[model samples]
Target chain A: EDQVTQSPEALRLQEGESSSLNCSYTVSGLRGLFWYRQDPGKGPEFLFTLYSAGEEKEKERLKATLTKKESFLHITAPKPEDSATYLCAVLSNQGGKLIFGQGTELSVKP
Target chain B: EAGVAQSPRYKIIEKRQSVAFWCNPISGHATLYWYQQILGQGPKLLIQFQNNGVVDDSQLPKDRFSAERLKGVDSTLKIQPAKLEDSAVYLCASSLTQGRFYNEQFFGPGTRLTVL
Candidate 1:
């Protein structure tokens, strides 16, 4: 079975504080790992897609790194505007479907 | 490009009432997907369509749920009798191809359904 799990269901941080969100997965074959940002009342927006171990992608203050067993999304100097649910999903090669984690609800307070 | 479009940004109805939602994918997108996201949860794939054909609908509850992409451009999801547990946001996404490696899905604003 393909499964994705995220840690620290929720996180609270003050402005300028840095933190990392974890996304661990167990799949038959990890085709790709994806990160998405979803705000309340809105659908998810794609962030980064990591294909192999040691791969990294960045956008603004967000950085995503991937390893064989899991992935991590590190936020630097987070602001209130960066508050949103960060979702991690693994594209399973078997079904060609993305199995998603429960998501990490991040709150960045000023 | 103008991203994916969806209808009925918000809908509220009692259980047992039927409802339908629509989505129009980006022009020329070969693959379309439907996902359900409950509050505080990640999106779950409900169905996937490649062009006008079904790619995967295994997770869809066939008892009272049905969907169609008649023209391979726009699609509709219908629930004959909704349940309270059905309250969630229905998201529609599309990608250039069905390949998982290079596929990056573009999502819509989604239709929020509240079943009372």
Candidate 2:
């Protein structure tokens, strides 16, 4: 069965603190890996998509790297405004659907 | 361009009642998706539509859940005889196309449903 797991259900970081969130997956065949940011009372917004192992993408203070079995979202000098739930999803070659992880709830305090 | 749009940002109802949520995907998007997001969890795809055709509905609860995108632009998701477990945020997303590995989906503000 295809499954995605995100570690550290919640994290509290001080402003300007850098951290990494993990997203591990088991899929038949990896087509792509996606990262999204979701704020309270809103739907998730697209962040990045990694299509292969050793691939990486970045946007502002967020960087996402992918591997054969997992992906990592590294935050650099995160601000309070950057606080939001980060979600990871995998699209398998077997189907066109995306399998999502539980997500990591991040809180940045000033 | 305007993003995906959803209606009724919030709804509260009793168990066993019926409710419907609507979604309007971005202009020219060829694919639409409906997802259920429980608190503290990632969004789960309930159905996927490609130009008014059902590409996937395997995860949707057929007995109580039904969705339609008749015009290939606007879609509606209905839950009949809602269960307490049905309480969650209904999210709608759209992409330029489906079956492409690089397609990025854009989401809308979800409709929060609370069943008592």
Candidate 3:
């Protein structure tokens, strides 16, 4: 069965603290790995998509990288505004579906 | 383009009561999805539709949960005789292609359903 597992179920980071959230997966075939940001009482917003290993994309303070067995979302000098539940999902060709990880709840303290 | 749209931001009902949630995906999106998000967990896909046809519903509780995307544009999900376990945020999302590229999925403000 395809599954996604995110590390540090919950994390607390002080302002300007840098960290990386891990999303490891086991699936038949990897189509894409997605990253999203979700605030409390709101839906998720698209963050980044990594298609293959060694591929990386950046936006402001966030960066995403992917490999055959895992993906990582790295935050550089994050602030309180970056606090939210970061979700990682794996798109599988086996069933044309996305299996999500439980997510890493990030708390950026000021 | 306008993002996905959902209605009844909040709904509270007693167990066994029937409740429905609606969704309107992007203008030209061919794929629509419904997900159930239990508190403190990731969104779990309940059903998926590709142009009004059921593509994947393996996780849907068909016995009481039903969904349809008439005309392949807008959709609705209904839970009849709801159970306490059904209390969760029902989220709607959509993407341009049914399944091919790594298109990003757009989400809407979910409907919070509370079953008493």
Candidate 4:
């Protein structure tokens, strides 16, 4: 069965801290891996899509890297604004369906 | 561009009651999706549509859940005889297209449903 797993269910860091969130997956065939940021009372906001192993994408303070079995979202010197639930999802078999991870709740305190 | 839109940001209902949620995908998007997200968990795809055609509804509880997208535009998801377990946020998302290629999904604010 295809599934996504994210570790460190919750994390707290002082502002300016850097860390990485992991998203491991078991799928029949990997089409793409996605990263999303969701704030309270809101739906997820698209962040990045990694299509292949060794692929990497970045936006401002966030960077996403993908491998055959897992993906990572690295935050650089995160601020309070960066505190949100980060979600990971995998698209398999080239279909519209997405198998999502439980997500990691991040908290950055000043 | 406007993102996906959902109606009734929140709803409270009793078990066995029926309710419906609506969604309007981004203009020109060819694919739309509805998901159920329980608190502390990621969204789970309940159904997916491509231009008014059903691409997937494997996870939807067909016995109590039904959805339709007419004219390949706005869509509606309805639940009859709701259960306590049905309490969750309903999220709608859309993408330009779906395939092996890269497609980014944009989501709406979501409708929170609370069943007592």
Give the CAPRI rating of model 2: high
What is the Å distance of residue B49 in model 3 from its true position?
A: 1.1
For candidate 1, lDDT tens digit of each residue in B36-108?
9888788899999999999999999999889999879999999889999999999999999876356889999
DockQ (Cα-based) per candidate?
A: 0.85, 0.93, 0.82, 0.93
lDDT of 3 by residue, B1-116 (tens): 68899999999999999999999999999999999999988899999999999999999999999999999999999999899999999999998886556577899999999999
Model 1 achieves a DockQ score of 0.85
Single out the weakest 10-residue window by summed lDDT for candidate 1 chain B: B96-105
Per-residue lDDT of B1-116 in model 2, one digit per residue for the tens?
Answer: 99999998999999999999999999999999999999888899999999999999999999999999988999999999999999999999999986644589999999999999
Cα lDDT of model 4 by residue, A1-110, tens digit: 88999988999999999999999999888888899999999999999988889999999999999989999899999999999999999988745588899999999999
Clashing pairs in 1: none
Q: Cα lDDT for residue A8, model 4? A: 87
Candidate with top TM-score is 2
> How would you encode candidate 4's per-residue C-alpha lDDT over B15-110 as one tens digit per residue?
999999999999999999999999999999999999999999999999999999999999999999899999999999999888646578899999
- Which ten-residue region of model 2 chain A has the weakest summed lDDT? A91-100
Q: For residues A1-110, could you state the per-residue lDDT of candidate 3 as single tens digits? A: 99999999999999999999999999888888899999998899999888888999999999999989999899999999999999999888787777889999999999
Show where candidate 1 strays beyond 4 Å.
none
How high a TM-score does candidate 4 get? 0.97
Pairs that clash in candidate 4: none
Measured with C-alpha atoms, the lDDT of residue B79 in candidate 4 is: 97
The order of the candidates by DockQ, greatest first, is: 2, 4, 1, 3
RMSD of each: 1.0, 0.8, 1.0, 1.1
